[model samples]
Target: MRTIIGWAVLLLATAWVGAVEIKRPVDMGFVPLRAVSYEEAVELCTPLLSKDGKLTYAKIKNLLVIHDYPENIEAVKKLLAQIDEDPVNVRVDIFMDQAAQEKSSSFDVNLRNVRVEHRDGHTRVDGGIGISAGQGSREMSGSTNPFIMAGNGRPARIWVGETVADPVWVYEYGMGQGWWKQELVNRDLGVSLWVLPRVLPNDLVEIEVYPRVTARGSTPLSVDVKELGTKVVVQNGATMPLGGLDSSRRDAYRRILGVGSVFNGSNLSISVRPTIMRMPERLRQEKARQDQPPEKH
Candidate 1:
């Protein structure tokens, strides 16, 4: 009977030592970029200190408090491997929530164990675990068509416009009297035009424009155009020259007519327009409501 009692005490003491608990809070300074799951924490620290391995309790507490869990699992694993291989001068400890452990626990699987060891002039730690949840996926579809045109001599112009559910308009012409017109070809991507005459040679021509944009329940439509080769912003009410022309009137004329004696050239233009059909107010209101965050229950 005495022997049995002694054995029982010994077993209880062993269990108590093995079951030592560690609890500590982690601080991810203001605005944490990522949150780690519990399973990741376990995978990262398991090798440094096993279920029954020797470890400093304070070190374990520190690990739990500073580690960012699975979010930083990869980094934690690398650090562990380094410490393990150099245990002579390195130490590591980790603790995870019970819920995370339960979630990570699996049956009939070859559980990967963390490794720690010290080698010639170096320490190494290896292995990592991760946990993920609340993942989602989405897909979107759209298209765009951009076009360019050049001129050889005569004053040339091109006009292009688009008519879609919501359209935008853009075009380019000489800085002089004529304006180019662009026809909307595809309702989806907008329009394109290339006009070239057989004769006349001149400087390069350029134009840039944008379609008017308006939200479903918004007021008047607004347009924004980015200047070609420059950071200039041009709006609907602004008049922008297709390309800066030379100051000399004769030079400008020569540039417009193509430098060669008998000038001939081409012009390019483009435009985007929208064809919006107003929807029912009720439907619009419903859509707006759906876009808003749900109220607390």
Candidate 2:
């Protein structure tokens, strides 16, 4: 009887360890700089960001261009015509509720009236530069046991399975690489479903989640997908576990499981942040980012 009890405790401990839980979510706050003026702010200071601040910078710049600075290029030209211009200040206060607490989050940066101060014979470019990493809102969906259909970070057709699937999911979470997924319980094995883009044929290049993430076992954990109802046989380690699956995302997970089910399964559809994605899609996102205007709150 003692042996039976001990084994039960051991199994329970294993499941508990493997269960997903949210570690500290991606730090989606303002990365405050030395507060340089618009003119002195060289090249947007893209490197100082937590991760690649290119896309985040693009978004911020778009905000400035549209409502503050060159958005009104004609107005800017007019200002240049004047010598000692009036002080124009565009206060940045972006506010956004915690949308995708697990995956990512963002806030609204308010675009105040441009403060046109002609300092040292030059009309300073209105406001200084500030960046907020992981700065975007997400209406997240679903929760599951990391039971994602292995494919193009999208819904996999039930009947087609891996044949029509996109092999792997590539997610680059270097923003919080150091302390993102801290080990919760001693034997905690919780999983978060991360669907990455297919850079090549089967690109499963994953940078370590936490330094000790490998303690879980392997990068693409091969598990049974039959639990999610797919003839695909097994999960192709496409979606990796990040943290514990909470109640908030249960709805979205249902659709992902249902999506492939011909009878009743929710389709998994997600908007990939091009700025944080790989090539092909990255290129497409860059074009879209350039062609698009500043997003309205």
Candidate 3:
């Protein structure tokens, strides 16, 4: 009986030691984020967390509070360091051109005894037809160049346009009398460009260009909006060209009992030039020194 009791106490002691050895103390780490947001860091660190790990954000100071194992904390730190990069600068130039075409001259003549024949997928006409040349010319319309700067995956936007007021007329019927009301509606017409630029380690830039144009529609009270967006990858210091936005203008005049029209049209092309501006090594070292906490006296 005494031997059994002694064995039971010894087993209990061994079990307690094994339990203590299996458990590990949770460690706390404070990490600073520069390029990426705190929320993004948490999202990235959540998957690598242990069962007892916790993450908190210090918004005022823009720091990350991590409570996890030492190895896990180190892993999170390394992951955040990989994505911390300098800002990207993009310059967008929009070019527009207008061309005017008018009916300069016309020739007409009566033709009789004309014969037409088709053979082997070809048409042959044995009659003389009137021919006239139309005059068409193009001129430089207008252009705009805008620059924007943003961090790694952030977006920057710029708007270049104008606001137009459209008049609306309404008729109301009163008791035995009719009245007309005139209201002015405001609209915006122009281009809105949103650019997202990402600089890779290999000196390549991935740009997302979203160009929206607002113009007048066919009807008086209607508005038209077109979104021309595309993704382009280009080398640093190179320009990427984007097209497909077209516009036109027309004016009419009354000439003593006749009306004439002057037509003008234009095509818009955009080119984006992205430049990666990295912080100098000396400046980076100075910034790091400034970010360090002051030593206690």
Candidate 4:
């Protein structure tokens, strides 16, 4: 009996020593999830989990279970606190200016049947017929400032173009009598602007802009398209210009009207301004006051 008691005391001491040597995982009790979904919270916390980390969720109750080392759990809590807030709303303002080459009524002057004579250091000039002819250009210029609002990380599109019917001719092969008929098909000719905005930290905005222009080609079946895509970062409520899309054509008139050359230009310029919705200071103060507990009598 004495030996048995001594052995039991030794075993108990060993067990206590083993328990002290082992470290238990900390359980950050179930926290109520508000703004973000359970799945999103899990995704955000997965990367911060250590080797022995464990996580679970109660979807019906909207509760998040996090179990890990004390430091990792704290980090996850901070992350959840940061991202579980109201969604951010962003508004994008787009300003577009399109100008096409405008040619004034061009005219040509010609001198014919001119006679000149010089006798005894005296110069004499005869009358000549002067002819003038002109042709006008058919181009237009316009400017538009269109503003659109969209949620952050979404795409907004604006189409400024026209649809026209195209003519198509078909021949009948089965019938002996040949028939000639024209069918009208529709075609779209215009410009489309797509803007995507993302709000980042530090009061900055990142924008993705895509501008496409389509026009009629030389042939009935041909079409011309011009596209430009770029990404830029700017401060909130600041405007940034889109570049690399300007074109000009020069028509040279050597002997007509003593004019050197005619400049015809088709220019496009775009400016983008992004504004993010933020909580007002006054409303925030009121909310803080309301969140406070009632005073005890």
- The most accurate candidate by lDDT is 4
Give the Cα error of residue 89 in candidate 1, in Å: 39
Candidate 2, 16-104: lDDT as tens digits? 76653223223222211112333322243323332322213233532222122222333332333343212222111111112232334
Q: In angstroms, how far off is 157's CA in candidate 3? A: 1.6
lDDT of 4 by residue, 170-205 (tens): 875655677777898887777666678888889899
TM-score of 4: 0.43
Runs off by more than 4 Å, candidate 1: 21-297
Instruction: For residues 86-192, write the lDDT of model 3, one tens digit per residue.
Output: 33454433332233343355454656568999999999888766555455443434444556776657887666678989998889999999999999989888766
Ranking by TM-score: 3, 4, 1, 2
Ranking of candidates on lDDT, top first = 4, 3, 1, 2
As a whole number from 0 to 100, the lDDT of residue 52 in candidate 3 is 79
- Compare candidates 1 and 2 on TM-score and give the better one: 1
Candidate 2's C-alpha lDDT? 0.31
Worst 10 residues of 1 by lDDT: 86-95
* lDDT score at residue 255, model 4, on the 0-100 scale: 12
**Clash list (residue pairs), candidate 4:** none
